[model samples]
Target: MQKVVLITGGSKGIGKATGQLLSENGFKVYGTSRNPDTISNHPFKLLPLDVTDPNSIARCIDLLKSETSRLDILINNAGAGITGPIEEIPEAEIKKNFETNFFGPVAMIKSVLPLMRENKSGLIINVTSIAGYMGLPFRGVYSASKGALELITEAISMEVKSFGIDVVNFAPGDVATDIAAGRYHSPLKESSAYKATYGKTLELMDTHVDSGKDPMFIANAIYNIITSKSRKVHYKAGEPLQKFSIVLKRLLPDRWYEKMLMNHYKL
Candidate 1:
C-alpha cells in the first residue's frame, strides 16, 4: 500500500517541490493551501486550508478523515516571514508571525496525533529554518517564530517517540523563494523608530534570499529524512557554508558566534 502524505502550504516554494517529489515517489499526497485553485498542475489533491484558523484546520482534517481514514506522513511546511527590527515591529505583527509559524504547526500536530497514535505509525516533519538557531538583525520576529518551532519539535519528538511516531525538525537555510522577496514588511509608520537600521538589514536579507540555494535541495533533504529508518530530531539543509555555520555555532563560544554574525551582517 502506498503511504499517504499531507503537506501544508503546498502552493509554492519548498512545500510545492516536496509535494511533487513525494507524489512522484509513489506517496498518495494531499497538499493544503489557502487558495486551492492556484495549485492546478500538481498531481496530488489540493485542499483549502488556512493554518492560522482553527476551524479551517478542523474542516480540512475532517475531509481527510472522511476520505482517506489514515495518514502516513504530515509535513508542517506552511510559514511566513516578518521583516523589521525587533523594537520597531508592532506587537500585533509579532503575534501574527508566531500564530502562523509556531501555532499553525502545533495546531496541525494536535489535530493529527490521535489518528497517528491509533495507527502507531507516522512521520511528522516540521520545516524550520536556520534562523531558528541564530538570531538575525532585522528578522528578529521571524527568527523568534522559528526558534519557538524548534523547541516545539524537540518536545514533540520526545513525547511521541514511544508511540512509533517520528517527528523531524528540519531546518533549511536561505532558499530562492518568495519568502526572500515577499516577506511582509511593517509599514513605515509602524517602524519609524528604527527605519534606518531596519531598512538596511531588510535589504541585505532580501539580497541573500534572492541568491540562496534552490528549493530542490531542500525537497531532496526532506525525502531522505522521511525515508530514513532512524528518526532525527534535527536536520539542516543548505550550502556548505551554512552547514559549517551550524557546526561553528555548536563549537564556538557565545562571544565568538555573536561577533561572527555581527560581522556577517555588518552590524
Candidate 2:
C-alpha cells in the first residue's frame, strides 16, 4: 500500500517541493493552500486550507478521512513571518502572527492525532525556523512564534513517543522564498521610533534571502527524516552560517550569544 502524506502550505516553496518530491517517491501526497484555485495541477491532490481557521482545518481533515483510512505523515508547513521590533509591534499583529504560525499548526496536530493514534504509526513534522533558536533584531514576532513552536514540538514528541507516533521540529534557516517578500510591513505611524534601525536590517535580510539555499534542499532533508527508521526530535536545514548560529547558541553564554547575534545582524 502506498503511504499517505499531507502537507500544509504546500502550494509553494519548501512545502510545494516536498509535495513534488514525495509524490515522485511513490507516496500519495496532498498539498493544502489557501487558494486552491491558484494551485497548478500536479500528481498530488490540492486541498484548500487556511491554517488560522478551525473550520477550514476540520473540513480538510474530514475530506482526508473520507478518502484515506490512514495517514502516514503530516507536515505542518504553513507559516508567515511578521517583522518589526516587539516594543513597536501592535498587540493585534503579535496575536495574528501567533495564530497563523503557532496556533494553526497546533490545531492541525490536534485534528490529526486521533487518526494517527488509531493507525498506530505516524510522523508529524513541524516546519520551524532558525529564528526559533534565537532572537533576531527586527524579526522579534516571527522568532517568538517559531520559538513557541519549538517548545510545542518538544512537548508533543515526549507525549506521543509511547504511541509509536513521532513529532519532528524541522528548522530551516533562511531559504530562498517569497515569504521574505511577503513579510508584513508595519505602517510608519505605528513604528516611527525603530523604523530607521529596523529598515536597514530588513533590507539586509532580504538581500541575504535572495541568494539563500533552494527550497529543494529542505524538502530533501525532510524526505530523509520521514523515511529513516529512527526519528530525531529536531532538524536544522540551511547554509553554513545557520548551522553556526545553532552551534554558537550551544557554546556561548546567553549574554555572549545575544551580543554575537546582534553584531552579526549589525543591530
Candidate 3:
C-alpha cells in the first residue's frame, strides 16, 4: 500500500518541496495551507488547515480521515517566526508565536498518535530549526518555542516506540524561504534601548535567510529519513558550519560559546 503522508504549511517553502518530492516518489501526499483554494499548481492535494486553531486542525485531520483512513507519516512543518528582544516582544505576540511554533506541533502529534497506533507503524517528523539549539539575541522566543518542540519530540519518541511509532526532530538551519516576510517583528522603536542592536541583528537574520540553502536540501533529508530503517532521535539539515555549531555547543565552555555568538552577531 502507498504510504499516506500529511504535511502542514505545505503551500510553500520546505513543506512544499518535501510534499512534491515525496509525491513523485510514490507517497500519497496531502499538503495543508490556510487557504488551500488560493494556492495553484501544487503537485499534491492541498487541504485547508491553520495550525494555530484547534478547530482548524480537527477539521483538517477529519478531512484526511475521510479521504485516507490510514496515515503513515505526519510532518509537523507548520510554524511561525518571531524576532525581537525578549523584553520588548509583547506578551500577546509571544503567546501567539508559541501557539503556532510549539503548541501547534504538540496538538498535531496528539491528533495523529491514535491513527498511527492503530496502523501499528508510523513516522512523525517535527520540522524544527538549528536556531532552537542555541538562543540567538533577537530570536529568543522563537528559539525557545522550537527548542521546546525538540525536547518534546525526544520525550514522545520513547513513549511511542513500543507502539511502532517513530518520533523524530528534524532541525533545518536557515532554509531559503519566505518565512522572514511572515515573521512577527516587534516594531523597531528608535527610543527603545535595544533598537540599535536589534536593528542590525534583524538585517543579519534576513540576509542569512536570503542566502540560505535551498528548501530542496531539507526535502531530500526528510526523504532519506523516511527510507532509513535505523533512525536517530535528532537529525539536522543545513550547511556544514550550521550543523557543526550544535556540536561546538556540546564541546565549548558556556561563556566561550556565548562570546563566540556575541562576536558573530556583533552584539
Show model 2 residue runs off by greater than 4 Å: 188-191
Write the residue-wise lDDT of candidate 3 on 1-267 in tens digits.
999999999999999999999999999999999998988888999999888899998998999999988999999999999999998899999999999999999999999999999999999999999999999899999999999999999999999999999999999999899999999999999899998899999999999999998999889999999999999999998889999999999999999999999988989
Report the number of backbone clashes for model 1. Answer: 0
User: Using TM-score as the measure, which candidate wins?
Assistant: 3
How big is the RMSD of model 2? 1.5
Which candidate's lDDT is highest?
3
Off by over 4 Å in 1: 188-193
- Candidate 2: what lDDT? 0.89
Report lDDT per candidate. 0.88, 0.89, 0.95
- Candidate 3 lDDT (Cα, 0 to 1): 0.95
- The CA lDDT at 18 in model 1 is 92
TM-score of 3: 0.99
lDDT tens digits, residue span 1-267, model 1: 889899998988998899889989989999998989865677678889999999999999999998797999999999998887676678998998899999999999999999999999999999999988888777888988999999988999999989999998999998999985556787655438776666667678888888887888889999999989776699998878877887899999989999998888777
Ranking by lDDT: 3, 2, 1
Per-prediction TM-score to the true structure, in the order listed: 0.95, 0.96, 0.99
Provide the lowest-lDDT 10-residue window in model 3.
35-44
